[model samples]
Target chain A: MFPTPIARARPSVRTIYMFGLPVSLFIWLIPLLAVMLTSIRSAGDIAAGNYWGWPQGIFLVENYMAVFQNSPIAAFILNSFKVTIPTVIGAVALSCLTGFALGVYRFKANLLIFFMFVAGNFVPFQILMVPVRDLTLKMGMYDTVTGLVLFHIAFQTGFCTLFMRNFIRALPKALIEAARVEGVSELRIFWFIVLPLMRPAIAALAVLIFTFIWNDYFWATVLVQGEHAMPVTAGLYSLNGQWIASWHLVSAGSIVAALPPVAMFFLLQRHFIAGLTLGAVK
Target chain B: MADSIAGKSYWHQNQRRIAPWIFLAPGVFMFAVYVIIPIFQSMEISLYDWDGIGEKTFIGIENYIELLDDEAFYTSLINNLLWLLFYMLAVPAGLFMSLFLNQTVFGIRLVKSLFFFPFVISQVVVGLVFAWFYDPTFGLLALIFKTFGFQPLAVLADERYVTYGIIFAGLWPQTAYCMILYLTGLNAVDPEQIEAGRLDGAKGWRMLWHVVLPQLRPATFIAVVVTVIGALRSFDLVSIMTDGGPYGSSRVLAYYMYEQALSEYGFRMGYGAAIAVVLFVIMMVYISGFLWSMYRQEREGR
Candidate 1:
């Protein structure tokens, strides 16, 4: 509403603006639209240079089925879920405790510890890549889903702790003080009081981490090498290599790879945006 | 008995202090091991020579010295700078898009979400989509080039256009991300300021430049930080779209480090660690600045 509402504009200008909405959206989503369409097209259409035209016939079922039948993408999708879910749970749970400590306590190391998480979160993955991979290998978890999950949980805790601490800090301090005056044990206060208030922060962190771990490519390639453990990002890359010019299959695989995070974002749009824009708003 | 009773009383008095550490222990331990320790370990590794599997040889700064003379190193470094520059365009582009879409209208929520659609999907998908779109023969861009009486540019295969091409694909998602940040910022912009600007005849470009943009500082700061980070982390898209092909013209330091350390180029883990250390130093410059500012803000807020 910052640039005067459309309703206040002259009728003709308003009409033009309304007309432009879908037109501009069409242009914005053209690539995605193309992929969506191509995902449903027959290989024959692509081979015949019918890339932009309506498919001669819809082969949506066959194209999608072929992506699963002819590739390890299913296992990759499973691996993505297997890695992402645990990371979300682990990171969010760990941050809740750390965030509570940093947010509630007046400990001497509070800001020091909080800043460590903040700085660690911002370090480029390459710096962490070599040693993390080596440690995972040494732990006998290399190329296993467990290795990826543990590292992701550890790395994501940095950002999540930052978010969770800020959120917890904003909660009413009196509530904790009142509980303390009543002689409630610290753990009980956390479990029975602060934990309930942290639901929104936890939801936000969960959605954000789910998308992050799902869409992750760098660590997937660095830590996991086998067919059983490759997440969809790396799996899709391998499929791209194998499929060559078969756009339909590649498009189908890409759609499959993208679906979970997309679904999570749509389902948790409010929490997702809340988490992402924590510092953007005043 | 007296000592035991005193010990119990002492533990009771200190439980408040100890509880926080107990809460922090697991998260801190994991972070130190996986994230912080590796940063120093990689730095130390950079001073030696070793394949990932071989016995380590101490050759201090030799890799860094070799990097000084490597043409590919210079190419990736220059490309990263260009990426940093080109990628900043997302901030302005996002502001413009958010301004265009800020009005109240029917189906605006859907429009906003759709506008943000690209970002929700994986970059691998985005990279693949763009690579196909820029494909020489069957691609839409190629068709346009053909219709214009010019040979289609095989962007990924061409060294000159490859980095720009990949950066453009990257911008698709990045621009959307910035738009969301600004959109949220715009929602928090004061209506009173806009009303005052309008009453004083500040409209269009003047209104945006003088009245609107100052309020968007936080959004712009975040947009720039994320963009800088995104530009430096330009690995997935490059790996997916071009694989640093056409003789590795498209390699950013991240991709090149991976290539040097792990790729079929042979596992020069020490050299890769050196490249990582360089990237880490470059990042620490920005990271520390951001932290200092945020720390100041935190103290002031307290």
Candidate 2:
């Protein structure tokens, strides 16, 4: 509204907006651009104090290969998938059922349970740290990807349930009522009627949860100790310590660690935006 | 026949009773065990002194008393307050970015998504990027300083500038998040209302203040909620960038709790739990406000 439509604006103003867009984007992405450039820099370029200059040689592949072959980055990436995929599935499946129940039913404790999930979702992980770790140890799931996944699923359910319930509640109620009148069991109504209609919500939750879990470093460090089950987020930290002055290798590792979620956002751009901006548009 | 009908209707009425619990059971169980129960357990554990390896001994309020006098703890608390205050710059910055990017120019969508790249990546990566950027010797900032005839400032190494430095790194991604939220909010602004306001010469700043902002309230709420939560959960960046180093000057409650309980600093589980409890109490205030508004919405929708 402030700029008005492009065609209507004065030619000079239009020219300014067009040129300003890319310039602002360049400034906005300076750190990222610097990192991207660093990732491609030859070690010689770094030594020669060409930090912001054009790269003397492209070492992108060599740097990436170093991260994978020289370090445990490959294993870390596999571990991330192992933790993140199950979390997305388990958390989503649980929330669908819970969301259906809370969205459709009228009973005591309905709002109470809903708010419980809401509150649980916002709580800082520190409160659950020692106890959850102890519990994981007792269950003998400690230091395993499964241990990490289980906690992620359980914790993410709080947020997923909040999302799913709100999404389902916004659906028209008459459809469920009519299904009930047709002698469909409540379970059938949930399975046939509600679940099928929740595709968008499911997609949104999947992307959101994937990003959240993939980016999780705290729990990764707390629950798992060794490289055997370390996700890339934590792996990058270890790599960070090890690389020390090796800027190129560190940059490559950082890029590798950032790729999955970045790819996820790009591939699922629409759904990702929908998921992130869920409450914003309303 | 009437008695039979009454019994059947009663079952139908009570079916509603059965449905919610059935749906809620698994989620509630998981939430209770993993979240709700642990919160209380942590609170209880805070009353005792235990090295994660040893038998527990009752410490009562000693941990809190020590925390009261501990210089590190006070520094962490003040840094957290600084974080909360400085992190809020994301909202207006986000608003400005959203406004800047909210246009129909060609390739704008791709640019907007690319701008959001930081938020999607792990904070560990962001930390690394910033760490390198602020590196005293061949880093970008140092390079700039060299050209200007000034010695490089080691932001992470200098205790005076360290916390603020880490927070600046955090704001990069956080502002991107707020930008996307406001962009969406701007997209959904009522066109008719903007036009209506325009008829009365309500243009530019007046149009935004009167017509657009009221509609953007939901986005504003979410931005504040996520920002507050993000400010408090300042562990990953602190850990990745400095590990609360340059003499633990960058520690926040979240990081301090972990360091005290789990890290090489020694696992004072009870003391750590006490710190966690304090953080939990702080979070509860905001969580309650968010929940209260959500409850009102749910009731209204019902």
Candidate 3:
């Protein structure tokens, strides 16, 4: 929009721009295309020096089924959902209240608390790794889905709070004041009034947190040790070790692992990008 | 239905006394317990010598002294610096990609989303993909090298290139993030300003440099902040790709802390805590800067 369509004749260059789009896209997605092609190739094709050639045999079904049956990939996918869902709910709920309070209250420590959440969100996970893992172990929650969920909830609160606070701050302060004048208790006002207005913010945070916790690898490795609790990210890495020369299976498994978040992104792309680009524009 | 101001003392006292602290409790409590307190705990623990299971022996500053002399620590620190420097390139590259895709061509939305796919997927997968891509025998790079009549370099296995190899994988996702930021920023640019610039015959990179870059400051700042944090906190990719292998050349501070605290080398919890404290201190500088900047912006808005 900002490019100002030069009113003078530039038809040839515009046509060239239109024509060049697809070629550029094709080049951009080369890595993904390679992975897709490799996933359908049979092992025999890979071994037969057919890396980039047309696949002599397509084994998409066989490779996908093999990844599930041969490894604990199904269990891993289930574990990812198990860890992801609860954290999404917990972090969003907590931040809604926190965001509301920070947005609505004119307290002395308001910015102090807000800045704490922002800073905490940016700190490296390593600084918290030793203590968090040890705490989880002491509570007998290590290697459990709940343990991962708890840590994620606590950790994600930082980013969610930042997003939610800014969002609530942008809402019309008049609405809350009008409700307050009608003698609505603050708690009910939050439950019935503010919460209903937060649908967009909630959707954004939910999609973002879902992708984040699902794709998480560090905590999955630190907290969980066995096949039962491993997420796809860790499971895929371990599988890569076992399938030494099985590029076909590896590519299939990678695709399978990547599908959920990719699907989520497409389905909720508006909210997803909205959530990501916070603070990008004035 | 209005509660008149004649008897406002009751409501005023209640609001003043109770509202803020009640609202602040849950968030502040969780943040303090999970984030703030642990920082001090790590600092305190760093003064001791223990393997996590045994009683901590207070050995004042020994870990710090050793870190100053440790070659591995130096290597990890230098690698972190390299990551920070190279990672900043994503900002300009992302801006260029955003400009390329800002047009309204057919299915451009889908194309944009596909370009962003790397950011949504886990870095672990990105690492695995690159590791396979760089495999000396059958990797894409190896295959290309063979076609050119050259020997394949074992990138991950080679000590000199291992850190750089891992950084390349990191840049993939990071660049996607920056592109999205710039795209969003580009969406908000004023059309009239561009029209005025065009009327003045300002075109090409000059128009972009003067008219565009000034408006994109917020986007640039956010991109730089996230990139710096991502580079400094790069642990997962290193862990997944090389596991600090080939003489631990790829050990950034975060991964080094994990290896010391949890791996087969046995838990040097105190030393690990020391390393964590150092990383935290460095990160605090950026965190404080971000906080101060935001605080000033908020005040100015008020």
Candidate 4:
């Protein structure tokens, strides 16, 4: 509504606008389109310098199948799911409690603790990498899915708490006050009242954490050296090394690696948007 | 019965004071151990000489002194500054895209989603895609340049263009991300305000600047914050695309620190930690400002 709507514009302008949309979209997605095309393209096409031309043949099934069968991509994909699911559950659940405390409580330490989480969320990973790895090694959890999962849950808690606290704070304060007046125990109020209303926040945070932990390459590389626990993002990097000169295979692997999060994004787009745009409006 | 009543009364009296901590304890414990403690540890490690498996020998500020004379450090620092500057362009580009696609038209949902597709994918994938797109021998860019009877530059291979090339790939997803934020913000803008502007005879760029852009401040703030953070956290693309290639022209502090601490560069843990500390200090300056402003807002909003 900010720009005068195209419906109110002249017919010629509207026609031009309609025509420009797809062309612009096409240009915008050219890199993705090229990769997608290459994924379905045969090795022969790649070898023959046919990156742009119509594929000499289609190898979508073979190439995609090879990504799973000929590599540890299946195991890597499983590893990602293994790490991501637990982190989502743990981070979101933990943040719910923390968010509740920070949002509802009027205490001396409330804002300080909240600010700590907020600040921790922004610290560069370099600052945390060496020590976190050492800590993980000390715990005997290095290079394992559980270790990665735990670190993610803890690290992601910062952002998740920030999100969850803001969301909880925005809820009606009078509701909590009324419950307090009735002598409802603090724990019971959180469980019975606040928890139910936090469904949207939980959904939003879950989707966000799932994508984040899934696509996490930095930790995966630092903590997990072996294919046994490598997430898809890092796994794809290793596969890039193995599949040297095979751009077609690499493209296919990239697509396979990207699919889960992309699907999650599409399926829960509203929640994803809600999570990301949390502070974009009053 | 008398004991139970006493216990209940005591809990009732102390509940307000104890309940929040009871809720906060686990998250606080985990965050402190993994996140908060590490900052100090990184700093501590920076002051000591260690190969990660040995006892640390403290030599205060020695690593920082060496970093002062390291050419690569300065290069990475400068590249980081450039990254910060160029990455800010995503904010305006995103706003423009959001404005362009703000209209309600048929199949717009799918179009918007498609525009946002680059962001959902991993940076590694974005890196690989751009790397291939910029491939000299068999890439689309080279082919286009060939058709135009001009030689294509090997962007990732050339030391001069390597950082910019990686930044370009980095910007694709960043712009898409910022566009999504702005789109969501635009959705919530008040129609009455826009009508008021229109009645005052504002149109075109004048309308956007005075009437609309002011309303989009929250989106802009978030856009700037994320871009700054993303620009600094630019290790993944550097690692994936060029690996600071063509004579280490593309290294940012994050990647450079990784090269020092890890990789085949022979884990100079102390030196790496020093680099990390520098990066941390740079970030702390920004982080403190961000937190202070957010804290002010939280106070004011209440």
For all predictions in the order shown, the interface RMSD in Å is 0.9, 1.3, 1.7, 0.7
Ranked by TM-score, top first: 4, 1, 2, 3
Alpha-carbon DockQ of candidate 1:
0.84
Cα lDDT tens digits for candidate 2, A63-103: 88878899999999999999999999999999998888888
Error of 4 at A52 (Å): 1.4
Ten residues in sequence with the least summed lDDT for candidate 3 chain A: A1-10
DockQ of each: 0.84, 0.77, 0.64, 0.86
Residue pairs that clash (backbone atoms under 3 angstroms), model 2:
none
Cα lDDT tens digits for candidate 2, B92-182: 9999888888888899999999888889989998998898889898778888898899999999999999999999999999999999999
Measured on C-alpha atoms, candidate 4 has an lDDT of 0.92
Over 4 Å off, model 3: A4-12, B1-17
What TM-score would candidate 3 get against the native? 0.96
lDDT of 1 by residue, B35-81 (tens): 99999999999999988777999999999999999999989999999
Q: In terms of DockQ, which candidate is stronger, 1 or 4?
A: 4
Docking class of 2: medium
Which prediction has the highest TM-score against the true structure?
Answer: 4
TM-score per candidate, in order?
0.98, 0.97, 0.96, 0.99
Q: Write the per-residue lDDT of candidate 3 for residues B16-64, one digit (tens) a residue.
A: 3466577667767777777777777788888999887779899999999
lDDT over C-alpha atoms for residue A138 of model 3:
91
* Top-DockQ candidate index: 4
lDDT values for all models: 0.92, 0.89, 0.88, 0.92
Rank by DockQ, descending? 4, 1, 2, 3
